[model samples]
Target: MSNSKLYKGSINTIILKLLNEHNKMYGYEITQKVKDLTKGELNITEGALYPALHKLEAEGLLDVEIAKVDNRLRKYYKLTENGTKETANKLEELADYIKTMQTLINPKLA
Candidate 1:
């Protein structure tokens, strides 16, 4: 599958989990971090990422802080308390999804 196609459904959960682990991250930093963490298996484009970030922020699951970093304004995103709880739920859901898919894809193995 194409990188975007493969990860479309899981991006939000990945982003949330990353923020849960790191506390806070900016947009580019988040993308780069995901690339690093996944060993390039997932490549998140700006077109896809910023919208999700904005949506999450709008939904009150995220808090943004604007700060100067090396003379450039950067918006950092951190999960709110509600976001943390939501992330936990989302992670569990993702785990279950993976298990289900695995079973469906290789029922003989199971």
Candidate 2:
């Protein structure tokens, strides 16, 4: 039973939440932050990350800016106005989902 399957569904929310907290972040930075926060239990792949970013950007929930650092162009992401609203909505939704899952996993805790 891999935890990846469990986390896959929530990746978007995770990304949005991180951006909300940090103001802005690059893709690799996002991946590393998650891994560090999870104590290496979770690893976010570029394959899963970039496509999600693209989708979010396309949906107008995210804004991208390019900066040249160390002579290389790096793309950074930040939440747009809509994204900030969406982040709040997603976080509330996630809290509900987690509560439901917790009740299912342990009725005594409910």
Candidate 3:
């Protein structure tokens, strides 16, 4: 399976979890953080990342702030009030999904 296809469902949860931990982050910073955390195993493309961010913003789950830095405007994202509440729930859901996958892969472990 393609990496994007495999990861298509969990990107929102991943982004929420990162924002939960870091308070705020910009797009490229978020991408690099994911790569570094995963030891380069997962690569989040701009094509995927930006759309997800936009969707989350539209859903009222994320708030954006713009800052002028080094002659460029940077947009940073942080979880909104609803997003903060949803982040915990999403993390739980993602964990459950992981456990289910593990159980399917190893019945003996289950």
Candidate 4:
């Protein structure tokens, strides 16, 4: 699968899960974390990352704090109380999806 297409489906869950684990992270940090975790399999582009961050912020699932990092302004994202709950739900849903895909892909084994 194309990296763009794969990220399209998993970006939100990935973002939320990262925030859940790390408490807070900036955009570039999040992108780098994904790369590190996936060992370069998943690359998150600015085009996709910013929009998802905006959507999540608008939906009240994320809280943003702007800060000066070195010589640049950076916006850090963290999960709101609601976001924490939603993260759990999203993770559960993702797990279910993986299970379903696995079953379908290996029905004989299943």
Whose TM-score is higher: candidate 1's or candidate 4's? Answer: 1
Candidate 4 lDDT over residue span 1-110, tens digit each: 13867458888999999999999999989989999998998889888899999999999999999889898898999999999999999999999998898899998766
For model 1, residues 12-105, the per-residue Cα lDDT tens digits are 8888999999999999998899888889887898988999999999999999999998998989999999999999999999989888988999
**Candidates' RMSD to native:** 1.6, 1.7, 1.6, 1.6
- Candidates sorted by TM-score, descending order? 2, 3, 1, 4
Q: Better model by TM-score, 3 or 4?
A: 3
The TM-score obtained by model 2 is: 0.95
Tens-digit lDDT string for candidate 3 (7-96): 889899999999999999999999999999988888888988999999999999999999998999999999999999999999899889
Question: Least lDDT summed over 10 consecutive residues: which range in candidate 4?
Answer: 1-10
Please list all clashing residue pairs in model 2, or write none if there are none.
Answer: none
On the 0 to 100 scale, the lDDT of residue 89 in model 4 is: 97
**Runs in model 2 lying further than 4 Å from the true structure:** 1-3
> TM-score for each prediction?
0.93, 0.95, 0.94, 0.92
- Give the lDDT of residue 82 in candidate 4: 97
Clashes of each: 0, 0, 0, 0
Which segments of candidate 1 are over 4 A away from where they belong? Answer: none
**TM-score result, candidate 1:** 0.93
Query: Each candidate's lDDT (Cα)?
Result: 0.89, 0.93, 0.93, 0.91
Quote the positional error of residue 103 for candidate 3 in Å: 1.9
